[model samples]
Target: MERMKEDQDQIYYHSGADLESVKDSPFLEKLIKKGYEVLYLTQAIDENMITQLLDYEGTKFMSISKDNFKFGEKDQKEEKEKNKALKKMYKPLTKFLKKKLGDKVSKVRLSNRLSDTVCVLASDQYGYSARMEIIMRAQAFADPDSFGYMTPKSKIMELNAHHPITKEMLRLVESGEDDERAAELGHLVYDTALVASGYVMRDSDYKSYADRMYKWIGESVGVDPSAPIVEEYPEEEKADSEEEKSDGDANLKEASSSSADPASEDHSEDSSEDHDELLYRSRTRVEDEVFMATVSVF
Candidate 1:
């Protein structure tokens, strides 16, 4: 919370920058640019405590994460107009994302606060911060069903107009509505932004995104995306005949009999065989998990 005079009614806050090494984020950068002195609430308790307190003296505390945060700068009007223009310019792509990513995001709009990043996720005025949701989900007693309702809904995605990635995406959106690649890329962008904002994603959705990423990687590597994987099987070793096995057993018996202290002999080879059995079991288990993941994605 910002230090205030006795008559002051407004307070500004900055959270999640406890460590001195924590550099300026898009949110903090925008605040700094506006010449506001923000009080950083680096500790987890700092935010929850402030939320409980609500106000100090006559001033109401405000969080940077909240959409209602506004710096009363004289040039704010011009900035608002610029942001509105950006939203209008990117309306097609925004609508495309909203439709394609239905329910995953509440809204898509032009970002007014970004400096360097291509896009970022912002919660509504009453919604939970990504950090707060993380804390809630981490609770041991949290019920999946009840927690779903308690969790924040509809994070607003803010896109930067200056970034090359956003620019290219806008171009793709303008190219045509029939562009399947654009739609795929749009989903990728949303997923990336969602994760980057510290929100959890459904396992199935994440797996699908990973599969799409692999396909993209294959294409980049000059491999055909639709091509079937070619597998090379190693040749099977020939099994020993019954007569050879008998001879080998006879030789082993003779050798054991020759040894005065057969029990004292090293059994490392037997132990190695046991280890190999365990290794094979472990490998099979891992392969089974991989298969399950692949199936879930599909």
Candidate 2:
């Protein structure tokens, strides 16, 4: 608090896992760049402590991760006008993002906190910060149902209107030629901001994010992401199939030749003639016996 400038009525701070994490936070980028001194709150209980303390001396304690944070600059009116203009210019893009993101975010708007970052997630003035949410989730035994009941509200997604990605996204949204692609990019950006802001994503959301990433990787490498995976055969397999077919043909030809052989036909004819001769001899014997019997009786 002693480090705060004379004109600054608010003491700014941001909470994170550690000093390194808070030091490189996107929320602190503009504050640090604008020559403001921000306190780093790294402990798990720091935010709770601040909630109780509220202020130091005559200054109020402000969390930079909240949407209500201000820079307390002298030319604030000029900045507000500038942001108002930007919001008007990017109204279509913000609407597109809100529609694409659906209920995941409470609102989409231009960011006054971002300088180097493209986007960030900011909580409501009375809502929980990402750090607080993490601590609560940890204490809630990782139960999502309990967490939902504890905090049912969604955070606001703030985009840097000056960023190149945001500019391109606005162009895509306005042109209407790449709605699908723009929606994909918007969801990706929202997911990134969620993680960057230290919020945990649901399993389904994480799966969708992973799928989009894989699709992007495939496209970047010139592969079709939607194509089906097929099994491929080698030259050896084709050669084996050809060999099997030839073996079958050879076996059929061998059987045909065996059935058409002259030796086999002659053997069959000889067996039939021998059987017919034996039958004729037996009949002649029976007829001679009958003739003898008849002569004796006469």
Candidate 3:
């Protein structure tokens, strides 16, 4: 009741047949500046009145009644008039979300509204309004079970006519959406709406969309999707490998010293030791001579 009042944005100190019976609503003027298709949902916003507003903006009425939407009459008529090749040529993403989120939905269907990217609207405008529940539950004096019985109603997946994702999704789905990308996209749109409407998305366990998104990031960085984790070759093990390598280098040095050839390039194994001894004696003599020369000069 309070929700209906707030939603109506009513004028005070009067009795009227409907909420919009306000002789001159200030809100309506502002809304018109934005050219919003505000359905003048006064007290008379019933089935017949809503039906009359269907072509208000040629469909921006927002008073889509269940009677008008009944049993595929108008939908069938619209579908027949539309290009058979085009709709089939492009995929409707809303259709995917409804199928995935079955029980918590009224129905998921394509929208003709080119305005909003997405909006959470009534499945049956007269049956259960998401806004009504919000308004009723918000009241200081309101019943609990009245709103408790209601859940997030029909999610109206409105695609932005100019959004790249919407365009790509159409091309991709029409081409074939059997791959994970399509699934991820469908999941993203649904999740965006859930978050937008301040509702908790409850399908985390069923689908790891986060994990999939992370893997996509990993792939972008030239990394493998299931790459093995690198274990730090334990600190102790790393020290041992370094020690072994150093010991091997020491051994090679010792071998080279012993295997030197005196008669070959520089020295050979046959007389390398003798050559080293002679070179040592020469160096010693040179050092002694330099020392003596220094002393004489002093």
Candidate 4:
């Protein structure tokens, strides 16, 4: 964070350029001693390591990224409230689209991820985010655009009340009942979201969707999806990283005194997926508890 520290307005001190050069600043030392709050933004910041470094510093280390980027919990509440209204509007249309797509896609459904707009083509758990795809394409590292083009992943059609075009659409649907225009509009909304979510639009020509959106914008103040964000951090996110270091030293002593087993060393190595990640690990910990309990007179 040495170079990045100067760019950050709030950062007080810059540690030297490299990891080996990193040492606690005298200023940070005083702050931690006084029980003050410090937010670490380093990309190299590891929680496990911090848990092991508490001995001399007597400080706590908490991750700010987990607090900031934690979206799963918030999405759950929004999902419940919006999904029903969305399903009512788009469910039939989604089924129709599924038939049109045929063997091209898995299945079609109404999106619970929609807030004020309609549709989003989301990937499953391990799929790449939009920005990540751009990097991969720039480098030509992965099958750059092969899986992107060929994947039969489908878009979920999500209809919303607050949407300007959608408000007009609901009125049209009510008036026409079984109109061809309403179905066309439904297709347009779904296609728009697909493009927005970094997927190729289903329609090569979106002249009608463009005209509809333009007409709506011309009549009103225009659509702005950027909502006012009120930031709140969870208290559960706070943990004492330094406590591990003091515990590590004491545990290491005990482990060394115990009868050495070559098998135990091999087992420890096999358990940890990362060697560098184990650098901050406190000695034996969960294993010690299990060993102590198991070896008791039975």
TM per candidate: 0.68, 0.75, 0.41, 0.35
Off by over 4 Å in 3: 1-34, 37-101, 112-148, 152-154, 203-209, 216-226, 231-298
Deviation in Å, model 2, residue 244 alpha carbon: 20
Q: Model 4 Cα displacement at 239 (Å)?
A: 86
User: How should the candidates be ordered by lDDT, best one leading?
Assistant: 2, 1, 3, 4
Residues 1-298, candidate 3: write the lDDT tens digits. Answer: 1322222322112112356433233223223333333444444224334445544323233333221231123434454455354445444655654666565555654444333444332234444333344445557878766665554444444444345776776666666746457666666666655554334445553366576666767878988878888877889999999999999999999889766744464545547789889999999999999999999999
Clashing pairs in 1: none
Summing lDDT over every window of 10 consecutive residues in candidate 3, give the lowest-scoring window.
Answer: 7-16
Evaluate model 2: give its lDDT.
0.87
lDDT of each: 0.72, 0.87, 0.49, 0.46
Candidate 2 TM-score to native: 0.75
Candidate 2 Cα errors over 4 Å, as ranges: 73-75, 140-150, 231-298
Model 4 scores worst on lDDT over the 10 consecutive residues at 62-71
Put down candidate 4 lDDT per residue, 46-164, tens digits, no spaces: 33344356332432232211111111234435556666676677555556656654443355664332344444454432343332343345554577456575233443334344457
